[model samples]
Target: MRIVVVGGGMAGTIFANNLARRLSSELKAGKARITMLSASDKHIYQPGWLYVALGRMTPDELEREEASLLEPEIAFFVDPVQSFRLGESHVVTRSGKVHEYDLLVIATGSRPVPEDVPGLKENSVHCYSAEDALKLHDRLQAFTGGRILVTVGLPHKCPMIPLEITFTMHDFIRDRGLIDKTEFYYTYPIGRAHSLENVATWASGEFAKLGVRQETFFNLKEVDGAKGCVRSEEGSEVKYDLLVAVPPHRGEAVIEENKLGPNGWIPTDRYSLHMQGDHGEKVIVLGDTTNLPISKAGSTAHFEAEVAAENAAAMVKTGRAARSYDGKVFCFIEAGKDRATYAMFTYQKPPEPRAPNAAMHAFKMAYNQLYWASVRGLM
Candidate 1:
């Protein structure tokens, strides 16, 4: 059996590592093969981008060479995938290299579509990538005082990121004694300002306490970067001195070009994570590639990857169905400099995510240090 994994982000790399380890005996016996195709050598710790934007961490600290983390036992390719021949279960690389596979795992994360909205590309400083985070870090570092606007576009990865940025900006400004000089503004298209209803209720109060005014159902439509103003689809408008927003998200061209989802995202069985192509060929997607209607945070990716890996391995080894993910997700929210909060839940709803505190902050700091080891299954 040949299993090919695409996109070497957290989901792809870790799933490949764990899957290969679980099938060690078959691997040694030459009964199965595992191969990973990564676009570049750089493997970034994505969640750390938030800390980067906060000026608490640097971009260099969040990146690692993807090849460095993959077990030597798995075949590695430094090939960027162009698209898939779904019917024949094959992938074509950018350089026209064709590879066939019995099972495919796609972990291609989403991309921010600033182009999706007119004038958006010229307006906000997005903190989704390493460079973007570093840019935001510099902007935040140099900012003296004024209204800081943070808005969230739809279908963003790490849905908690803008929230973390909003809260962290408050602390950042406060540390410089500019908190009083600056007013923080936030807006979301969602009704409660967050995905989980109850959590939104609690967080809204926290935002109020911190003097961060929030608006719901305000979908970004146009940006007037010159005037530091934004107009929402609902006709609401906000003006600020600095604008930071997560643009609308869409899946990469690999799936999008193939007519995968309603809007470039590949739709999968919510429980199984298996995507059925037009020819009835199925591929398992573990991360942002799928339109799962859940938070596209790293935690969701981690859990989905584990579940998908188990199922893929079983399908190859024993023709058995694996366990369901049950929509389990975990998230840590940093409310300020020394404190943070956490939430853990399943499909239906979440617990009241922990209130911000020093312990949670310390926990996050420790996790950052141990992330590589954890993903490599060494800790």
Candidate 2:
């Protein structure tokens, strides 16, 4: 049997590594073949972008070579996927190579597209990527006693990242003796600061206490960098000296290019995390590719990887039903340079901080170290 895994991002790498180990005996016996495809050999630890922006960690700490993380028997390909020929059970790469597979796992993650929103491309430096985070770091370093706005575009990844920026700036500016002069403003599009009601209440209260004005129902409409301002759908305007904007995100172009998805996202089952198509257990999808309402976070992808692997294995072995994902998501956001708040929940329930303390902060710090181990299938 031949299997092809596309994209070397979180879900793809985790699934591929685990699957390779699972089928290790088969690989040695010439009963199974697994090939991993990535757009680049660089596998970036995405969550580290936040730390990089805050100057807590360097970019070098989060990057790894894709080939180093996989089993020796697995074939690795460094080529961009042009399209997925689902009906033919093959994937075509940019180099005009075709990879046929008995099973295909899709995990090419989403990217922030500030250009999608008018004027945003000119005004925003985001924490969504290493390059973007480094740009933000430079902007923050030069800032001296001016209004800073941490705002979001709709449905962006990591709902808590913008909030983290709001708090991080408080610490960074305070340390530089500029907190008294620099003002903080954070805006959320909907009626609350976050999706979970309890989490929102706690965060908004904290924002108020920190002098970070939190505004709700202020969906971003446009931005003007030269003007140093942003306009919202609610007819509200906020001026800023610098903007850390969480731009809108969309699934990778390959999803839309193959017509395997609508709006650049593959329609997926909420519970099973399977691609909604007639592929008959041949195609499985997870992470940013799915249309689930959960936060598009590393933790969500971490958990979803397990669900997808178990289901894919069951489908392969017994042609049985796929297992269900409870949508359990855990996130720890840095409330301050030293303090953090954590939440855990599923689709039906909202998350509440069990104990938003320093211990959880320690866990998150350790998790970053373990994250690399996870990529190597050590966990």
283: Cα error in model 1, Å: 1.4
Per-residue CA lDDT of model 2 for 180-285, tens digit only, reads: 9999988888899877678788888888888888889888898977788999999999998888898999999888878877657788888877788688367878
**Alpha carbon lDDT of residue 124, candidate 1?**
80
Compared with the true structure, what per-residue lDDT tens digits does model 1 show for residues 1-379?
A: 8888998988998799888888898899998899898888888898888888877789899888887898877888989788788788899988899989888888888888888888888878988888988888788888888888888788788777767788888888898889888999989887876776766887799888898999889998899877779999999989988889888888886677767776777878888788854643457888888887788888888888888888878877788867988998888877676888888888876567756789989999999979998677554
lDDT accuracy of residue 129 in candidate 2:
84
Error of 2 at 268 (Å): 0.6
Q: Give the range of the ten consecutive residues with the poorest summed lDDT in model 1.
A: 274-283
The lDDT for every candidate, in the order shown, is 0.83, 0.83
